[model samples]
Target chain A: MRDWRYWLAEQRGTLIALAIFALMFTIYISNHPAGLTTNVAQTAANKGTLLALVAMAQTLVVITAGIDLSVGAILVLTNCIASMVVTGNAFETTLGVVFVLFVGALCGALNGLIVIYGRLQPIVATIGTGAIFFGIALILRPLPGGTVNETLADAMTGKVFGIVPASLLMLLAIVLVVWLPFCSSVIGRAAYAAGSSETAAYMSGMPIRRGKFAAYTLGGLLASIGGLFLTFFTYSGQASSATASTYTLLSIAAVVLGGVSLFGGRGSAIGAIFGAFAFRAIGDLMFVFDFDALWQPLFQGVILLLAVSIGALGLWRVRNRLEWFG
Target chain B: MSDTTMGRLSERMPRFIRRIEPPVAISFACIILLLLFGGLYSSAFLSADYLLQQLKVASFLGVIATGMMLVILLGQIDLSVPWVVAAGAMMACAATAYGPAATLAAVPIGILCGMLIGLINGIGVAYLRIPSMIVTLATNAVAQGLMVVYTGGFSPRDFATEEMRYLATGSLIPGVPNALIIWAIVGAGMVFVLTRTTFGRAVYGIGNRERAAYLSGVNTRRVVMIAFIAAGGLSAFGGVLLAGYASKAAQGMGDAYLLPAIAAVVLGGTSILGGRGSYLGTVAGVILITLLLSILSVLQMPEAGRQIIYGVVIIAMLLLYGRSPTNQ
Candidate 1:
């Protein structure tokens, strides 16, 4: 294959995810009662953006070929923290926002430390940390009642220029600011290299550990960003287990949908964003069509199964069956 | 000839000793330590009756962990457990409305449903070669959705049949909960299969290296399929017992079991990467975890604190004993 062809092949997953999201979203808007009005668009954008941020976080970790089961817990914890601190005066709210982000970064760093220095598997370590994060969140708000700065929440969640969603714009800005630099950096390449083949990356003297750590820490920050938005949208924080587990699972699905390989060294956060949007759209499609709410889980599951099965198509092309183990 | 055979056995002893055996010991040690701690906390905790009750409770977890161990042994996982468990319970309960005969068939029907799910998981994983994690997760979601639709998004109206209640709660022998007996029977059966049968050896062979096993003329795909189906069926059986214990089924009943089941399996010293572990270690793990949770509840710690403790303990155990030569 030519270089461009290889690049396209590498990007097929993301592009397909984008296409799916675009198609679903178009269908969703056209069938809706309001017909793509700002209110409806803003609502969808707000909901989708929350998952997008978390999925981006998941993408970063997954690109390193490690999973973070605690991302959702971090989201809940930060949401709870933000609800308490992201209130009162403007200066205080700014400080609170910074603090919330820092806490998330700290949580990620803790995970990184355990996985890297402690040398534990990512899945078990994160499951543990996820539990701890939830515990802390539960302590923060025993009862789900807290307020955020309404001004900030409204501004971030509301529409921009009476049409485009502000949250959507923020998502674009995050991609440009956070993902672009990370994608091009040497450490990012190191992460990809490590994920693709750790032994080879180690032999080549790549700073694989540093790269992975950065991915994990950055993943935590992104999850917190999602938490911030979640608080903004709900105007409160809830220490709900159902929400936490759902987001964690959904983020993994989105990461896969976005064309990011669970095996690592492949995919893009931008693709994951689209994947998240598409996943959310699938649920909304049910709503728009007036399907019984009970069928939503079943519908989502079938679509996810089919979507994941598509990735398995490459297995048939494997000449050596042993490669399946890899 | 006898001397040479003895020498050969001695030569292999170290390798056998080194083969991830210490974690099982460590798990037992932890159980003892936990018991001591519990005893210190409350007099009731030290009572034989209380301890027996703990064992009975642990039995439920043990059954689920047993199935989890099989899949993990094959170097695979089944994330569909939670909903499969709930589905088994709900379906079995729903069957009871058909009267006595249906009530008698409830458990078998529930297990069959689980087996069907396992078959699908097996096909996806062994045949289609999709990752088990994704496939089972999707299955879980589908099962949950179906159950929700069946129940109309409310608590299930059907109750557990008389047989289920007897199996879950009744004591056939003094101080022996029927649940414990059922678990013991399942455990014994599993031990026999794992140790005595060609199928047992195949599970280990495949877990160690599927390609190698296939090359050696083992039906690797069939083995994988069987393992997954067994896992699904066992998980569903656990669900049935849980419904019996509760005398009813409720939404999300299986949700809480998934993590703990995995934790128990891992804590028992089974490698999450697969192809290495023991039923004995898992048994210890279940008991240890049950005690930990029981004590945490006795301490009146809030749910959040309990979760934190659970997570921390799991990580600690992994670090303490899960690391073996194979992990690297």
Candidate 2:
């Protein structure tokens, strides 16, 4: 029983977030009366997939003790580029998608290079890049109206096997194939080591600069995936229409809520996925309650504060208790 | 050997120039560039009227930057500047609606609002041990929320009055902005506080090492609180002037100042990680950034081009003056 208690405490943030999600789902199910239908489950799963992808990307950067303020900008820019290239043909759409992801990677690489070689602070560097990237997106489209091929969008958003959503499958593949291996690799281990103590990492002969660059580059790749999902869900692209800036903050909040420390060095990609779901679920619940639009930003701000505080408090408690345990 | 020495000297010159902080150097370069362009293109750039007009515009940003400089020196940031400015302007305007008695009350109220918000931020960071970035970001959201809820996204017409306009638009020197005078006074005051007061030394001490400062019995919390309150007051004053200049308060007016204020602080050589900075550098940074914008406007560049230029300037400045690789 004591061992179970300790295990539960170790996973408190994830456990609490899950509880909140379940509670909200229950409320939603009771109110709607079409409780737990296949369609409803698929919709929830689809939404969760999109958020999970971005949250996972966010987790990589956060684990390095850096925040990517430009994630939303990258998404918007990629979406804009994709919209501009989509001529409503399937081939063009596929080509455009590839081009968009490439652009996203390039953007991320630029950020990484600047932070690594140019020696700019991550938050400040990202902020400047974000503004520039968003500006380029605006210049490309100027307005919020662009058509995407409806067929492709539907395929990506639709369910597969009558049980699993297509989005969920993509997300699972990313986790199983990409993130899982990366987390177990030497580069990934070095990232956490660097985050925990840069001086010590250096003393230990870890490639700190290269690790940071890789972390940021990976963040960019994840952001591109998020952009693709966003494009799929919206079925179009609008430069001014998307909520990209909000997502940057949301990604950070989700990562932090999922037990990723802002100070870095300790968190999991899986935890971040759960954090994203918790955040999205809260918003879904708020919509169900008919809260005014103006109140939403305020509510989000309040919740983010609470989540960060809890995370910080939990870590502080654990550190002190562990010292006593020792 | 002599030829080698000359080559070495030439290489070192560019490095030295780069080390001199990009904003300051760029401001000087841009001024000369603008002057040359104006001489070639328009007769107006060298005109006293144009110079005075530019100074007037710079003053609004300058006043807020002055207060922002102090906060930045302590290695914390205030994202709440824009809202504080708007609130101050609104308070001043709202007071005028109740006649003279209310207008008198409004000034203090504006200052008080700034101080109160700063106190909240200070408490959260110092006592609760929350990160300043998250605390200030949340406060900014709250302030913006309050503004939207209170004003319903529209400026109150009754808030603007003759008295408020005098503060915003009325110049001490004909053709110079009254805001310039206010900025100068505030700048001088900050110089005094930063240099003359024991409290100022404490700020530096705390910024350098919070633990050491605490051990030495410096009230680190109080210093942080004071810095935030001062920032709040300054931002509010800037807002009041903004309301006057525009003839009314507007939503998102404060949003534009966030990047510029922080940019100015950093440009002025204040370290973002806290500890070691200068008010004079911030003053120079403010003038330089303001001039860069004015020059862009004078060139009649498209908004997109101007934004690109702004981003490039920020990046270039950071590259030039950022902490060295060895230091990191």
Candidate 3:
């Protein structure tokens, strides 16, 4: 195969996710009462972007062959904090945003510390931290009422030039600023190398710990971004456990659908973004068809199962049955 | 005793102590320490009535943890547990309107519902080669949706039968809760299977390394399926008992149990990575957790604080025992 062919092979998962999202959105738009107008697109973009940011966060940690179960909790925690602090004057809101991002990084750092120094499995470690984060969230907004700066929330969530979504632009900017640089950096490659084979990476003198730590910290920052958007959209913070768990679960599904290998070392945040969009569409599709909201989980579950099962297709191609266990 | 005799005793103790798994020893110590703390908190804490109540509470967690242990032993996880528990309880409760015989059959039928879900989980993981985590999670969501559609997002109206209520809240022997008796019986059976059965041996082998187990003529797929099936059934059984305790099953009642079940298993010295652990350690863990939680409630700590404690305790325990020399 040519070099570009290999690139295509590498990008297959992301491409599939994009295609899936495009197809779903097309169907959604055509079936919609308002069609593909700015209002419809903006509404969809705003909802999808929240999940995309979190899915992007999950993508980073997953690239290091580690899963952060606390992403949604961090989102909730930051949302709660932002509700209290991201208010008052413009300067105060800016400071709140920065502070919320810092809090997220700190949470991610804590997870990395425990996983590395404590030598604990990432899954177990994150589960514990997730609970801790949710606990903090519950304390922050024991009641669901708090305000965000309407000026900021409106600008971010509103349409740009009445044609394109501001949220979509923001997501694009994040991809360029956060993901692209990380993808090309030495640390990012190291993270991938470690995920693929830690022993090899370590033996090659790669800074595996630093790489994974960066992935986790960046993951936290991204999730906080999701939280910020969530606060903007809802105009308040509610420490809803249902929302937290659902987001966490859906982000994983998005990551998988985006063609990011759960086994680690491959895939992209871009793919995950598309995966998130595609996943959100699954719910919207139900609405367009006038299906009851009760059917949403079932549809999401089936799609997730089918998408994940695609990853398992390789098992059939394995000549040795032993490889199936791997 | 002389100083020389004390020195000799100390010198010999490490060798004996080394034979006991660190998590097992630590959990037992925690149980004792917590009991001491409980006694200090109130005179009622040291009484048999209070302790027995604690045991009764622990039994619910114990049953769920037993299934969790089996899945973890196979180097897999079952996130489907929450909904499986719900499904069992909901279906069993729904079955109660038929007649007396149906009420008696409700328990088995509930477990069977869980078993069917487990079979699907098994097929996905074993035959399809999907990761257990994703497969089970997907199933959990599916189960949730199904239950929601069935119940129309409300609590199932059917109540637990007298039999179930008796099993959960009634005492089988004087001063002994029937729930505890049930847990003990289940624990005893699990211990026997782990220590003596070929199936047990296969589970350990697969956990240690599945490829090697497969090559060694162990029916790895079959074993994995059976383990998951058993886990599903047990979780359902726990839910049924919980329903009885509450007098009715509610949507999402099983949600709180998932993490606690995982915590109990890991705290009991069972490796989350699989292939290691003991039922005795789990018993200690269940008791310790229950006692700690009860005391936390007694302290009037808010729900948020209690959650924080649970999370912190799990991580702390992991740091103490989750590590192995080979992994690092």
Candidate 4:
């Protein structure tokens, strides 16, 4: 039907991302020492889930046409916070999780306030806040040693049944809980409008600032969720600048791979999720193919450049040079 | 403390006199405050040698930030700075294995690598129309990978050539560091370009509005390309000096420059959105940051405290003057 064609066009990026993930995963599993095993699936799912959450966070901000360089800082800070407070009994752990999420949302809100009211560019403002967050994280966890509630961590990271990964299920739950509602809400439309064209959005009386604020706030919340997962997976937290920079870079790469336009307002977190998975698959392929670990960064970089170039190919069709700015 | 008095005072200042911008003035004032504060810890903070030593260090950042300033003025960014810098250092060092005569070609070879990286960045941004941020970042990752593979490990084995060493650390003039003199020459060139040249005017015009600039017959794409290429090359040159200063290149050597360079450019009252900044502001910013770091160390602050203070100070400075209404 014509309606399905329109729907398919809208869903094209997500589908392509999914296809890429499927293809890479197929290659990875076929070459894996133990092919398609639950352990392998679980391991892959665990790693993919962390990036998926961060990439999903990035997707919200990118959708609003602003980049958050501080996502990695928020993740690192939350992880450090969780490591310290998410200890002892069940009540304490739950409290710690809530607190970490709160801190993340607060960080996002601060970034939004600075951008919206302070009238600063997102790039510099986020860089400053990122440094501040990282500093706090360093103070909180000067060394890499803390414990999460093992029973809860185990349940979260373990397989959901005899087959499916719990981390994957958690990712789905988050999508259902946070992203779906946000996507359907009027705020989401406002965000899309703002990203599409802020002046036009403003003229049309769309709630541009509020929409962006919500996007950034939710971005922080989602990044904190990723941080919690990292603490569970590693069983500790370290204020590692290397990890923070890596996550920030890879998350942006994943968002691009997921087909989210850096220009804004053109893709879904679902696409980003698949993109994160495909990205993880690239690294795993390196592991299986016996490529030296040193080659992974280069391999990933090449893939990222290729993906970005493919996205830019459509621009070649623009007849007017001015459209390049548009 | 009162607005009316300050307004009248500013209004009374003659246009030909070139009144100091509040942000730049405040930065200089902050530098003095840092020195005074450090002076309490040690008399050495006020001494000529200590000040010159700080100046020498600031020159490296000044050189890098000069390139950064040009790109920022054009309303674009080159995030590939880290690896471009690394690649430059490594290439210069790697050339030593070819023998002494080839060593003569090392600096040029290093800078050329940087320009090549810049060319790719420029093409992606100018022609392909990929966002500069994303393209530069991807190239950074690629450069990182290339550097990693080249060294075969965490650190490079080659030593800095004699020319590289002298250029970085040797004094061509009595009592003045060669690096400082190099920075001064580069700064003067930046001033001339940004103020005097058609290319420079095109960069400002494009930053203000690319569509309008194109309509006005400016080659917006070419200007953007050249700005990025210049940025990459300058960043690499900074790296070469760094490698030479240390007598060797190391892994992740450029990692430390990105934030500080950006911070210096902004603190000097350059609008992050683009097309507005003075070279003088950047100079003040560089000195301010260097002094701040020195004072923080003098105070025996930990890295965490230093970082926190650094971030807070930048935000405070920006908040003070960065909110001025646009020229329009």
If candidate 1 were superposed on the true structure by all CA atoms, what would the RMSD be?
A: 4.0
Off by over 4 Å in 2: A1-12, A42-49, A161-163, A312-326, B1-33, B90-100, B153-159, B324-328
Q: Write the per-residue lDDT of candidate 2 for residues B1-328, one digit (tens) a residue.
A: 1336545555667676645544455555655676677667777877888877777787789888877877766767776786787777776666666667877676666667777777777776665666676677667766766766667655454356665577778976876678778778888888888889988888888777777777788888788887888888888878877777888877667867877887777776677656777676787778777867777777787665655666676777777665434654
TM-score of chain B of 1: 0.91
Which lDDT tens digits does candidate 3 get at residues A53-138? 99999999999888888888999999999899999898898899999999988988898888877888888899899999999999
Chain B TM-score of every predicted model: 0.91, 0.86, 0.93, 0.93
For residues A1-326, what per-residue lDDT tens digits would candidate 2 score against the true structure?
Answer: 66998877656656765676677678876766467787887888788777777778778887787777788888888887877775467787778878887888888888889887887777778877877887788788787767777777787788787777888788878889878887778888788887888889889988888787788888888888887778777766766523765677688778877777777887777788878877777766767777776677767777876776674464456544223111
Top of the candidates by DockQ: 3
RMSD of each: 4.0, 4.5, 3.0, 2.1
What part of the reference interface contacts, as a 0 to 1 fraction, does candidate 1 reproduce?
Answer: 0.74
Q: Write the per-residue lDDT of candidate 3 for residues B1-328, one digit (tens) a residue.
A: 1336545655667676756665688788988888888788888889988988999999999999999999998888898999999998888898887777888898998899999889989988888888788899889988898898888765455688887899899996988999999999999999999989999999989988899899999999999999999999999999999989998988889999888888999899898888988888888888888998899899899989978988999998888767645433
CAPRI classification of candidate 1: medium
When only the first chain is scored, the TM-scores of the models are 0.97, 0.88, 0.98, 0.98
Query: In what order do the candidates fall by lDDT, top score first?
Result: 3, 1, 4, 2
Q: Write the per-residue lDDT of candidate 1 for residues A1-326, one digit (tens) a residue.
A: 46999899888889999999999999999999889877998899999999999999999999988889899999999999999999999999999999999999999999998888777778778988999999999999998979999999999999888889999999999999888998799898898997899888988988989999999999999999999999998989999988888898889889888999888899999899999999999889999999888888788778778877887888979998778766
Misplaced by over 4 Å in model 1 are: A1-3, B1-20, B153-156, B324-328
- Maximum-lDDT candidate: 3
In model 4, what are the clashing residue pairs, if there are any? Answer: none
